[model samples]
Target: MRAHADAFIAYATDPDPRVRRASIEGLGLFLEDAERAVGLLQERLVHESGVAERVLVVQTMADLVLRLPAAAAPARAWFDALADSGSTDADTRLAALAHRARCAPDSIDDRTVPVVIELLRRVTPAPPPEQDPAPDDRRPSRCVHVRPRRRAIRLFPGTSPQHSTTSNATAGSMPPTPLLKALHEALGARFDDRKALLTEQLRSADRATRYDAIDMARRLIASWRGDHTDLAVHSPM
Candidate 1:
């Protein structure tokens, strides 16, 4: 696989979605080379033929971010753009919601909270029996031939009509149960003095200040996670 990496990397842009997806999945095996690997994978997000393929590009990028956190700012920005995109569809809004939350947590109180609540109401325990078996998009997989059917035309809660457009493209709904569970957990999670601390995370320009703010938040998430970007990526980079 190491010897053939160049060929496989080239295949990430292949005309076939299957090849593109497999190539992205294969790229995951080379996270140690963060600069080259992330550079290669970043372009694929735009070139991917479909959302499912794009998400693989993302997931693989995420794995790389675990190795090179400096690469995260751009990816985080991309997810927020996807979420806040006025021209993007509700499915995109739905897909980008959690990620946007991760990227721009400040929006949770102002914008995303309402959008998520509304999305929760429309969500079914399953993907409606009919849509249950549709091809999964957010995860990379071997089954790339199947096409996704358009799901419901969900709302983007607070988007003033001018800021949002309805996405009519056919795509399967993300499984609702896990989504609901995650949201519920988020809702239930405890936070002490979030306003003061989160404001610092969002405002401070100093990398160290931002790092400290984020580390405080992580201490809340789990003590074992370690320093984020300001601390730098682990492993041989």
Candidate 2:
């Protein structure tokens, strides 16, 4: 597999949905083999029409960019391309925006935050209208693929009860859950200086501020656990 980049490349053109999906799956496996996975994903972002495939590509490429910064350069164009594509579906665009929010938080400043925030708000759990029919008390359906806890272990470890609880709630919801997305924004804002910001927030002047930050931190940790647990339960072995 180490020397089989071409083998993985074959799936890039496969027509069958399952075959295409497997080919997309192979890209991740071949990340080590395919030095050009980043480039390949960038190209796919423009031409690929499948929502699930686009989401997977965006998510995988986002992780790859973060892990291999040198490989991340080409992804910036993908982000811009996705953002500019009026033809792309809302969910796919939103997923791309979410990745952009992670990959280039600063790039989404005054001009874009409002749009992203609006999208987030629209997708957020809505309080029922007064005249609406009573709904089930059960938790809502969540995004299907949340990566896993292994991916989030370093960024969000369940160090407190609050963290554990939040993690569960995040995992129980469908993909693009606002809480998970909010945490991503919050953490992205801090970037490499996260630890310092966490420490500062934990020691903030206002008691309310400290509590709020702590609460958010807990939720983040819990979300990571939820993602990990969900993957373990549903993943094909």
Candidate 3:
């Protein structure tokens, strides 16, 4: 990987937007030199014209902060800034939360849990009825049930989080989002307070809150048993 570091750096500014974003995503994986990698990401953030690269930069920075203890403070500050900013795009804004979850889980309190839980809720338009129109004037057909009006419904699909390499938060990796991963960290080791906060979330009357909390626990236990294959959260839409 080190041998191709220079190529990846150069490709970060490729003329093709797709190549540029792909290279940016690839650069985050090369963790040989943390500071240098971060510097390059910052530079790319300025030069990039599209939201995709910017989102990549933000997500990569979060991954860096998570892996390299030295990448905190500055990176965390940037995440907080973006998260708080009204102008921030949805993916970058959500990616910002990853820094809080992974690098500063202890900072998460009751106020923070609601925001994180909010991330798990997916706002999707309700689907049309699975049943088709009845043959006659709807003569008491079992299939002719009351279809939900065409309106948006909230799904607790664990709001927009992504794997480090995934550029799109809304449409990310098979693994649970960064939020889920952060909750995984909370279950043991350094985040006792975070664990307590999440434990409280499990009892919330709101089904979305409880579902996300349970999913977090599910991911935590799966990781403990060395079971990565079962971490995918199927959306109950």
Q: Which candidate number maximizes lDDT?
A: 3
Higher-ranked by lDDT: 1 or 3: 3
Can you list the residue pairs that collide in candidate 2? 141-174, 142-173, 142-174, 142-175, 143-174, 143-175, 149-228, 163-218, 167-222, 167-223
TM-score, prediction 2? 0.50
Give the clashing residue pairs of candidate 1, or none: 149-171, 150-170, 150-171
Instruction: Flag regions of model 3 displaced more than 4 Å.
Output: 31-33, 46-54, 118-137, 140-179, 183-237
Off by over 4 Å in 2: 32-35, 121-174, 178-237
lDDT by residue for model 3 over 169-217, one digit each (tens)?
2333222234445545643543443454455445433344444556665
For each of the candidates, give the backbone clash count: 3, 10, 3
| Angstrom error at residue 50, model 3 | 5.6
TM-score quality measure for candidate 3: 0.55
Q: Per-residue lDDT for 201 in model 1?
A: 37
Worst 10 residues of 3 by lDDT: 165-174
Q: What's the lDDT for all of these models? A: 0.48, 0.52, 0.55
* Cα RMSD to the true fold for all candidates: 17.8, 13.0, 8.6
lDDT of 1 by residue, 168-210 (tens): 2224433322222233334333232233333433333323223
Model 2 Cα lDDT, one tens digit per residue, 199-226: 4434433333343445455544455432
Name the candidate, 2 or 3, with the larger TM-score value.
3
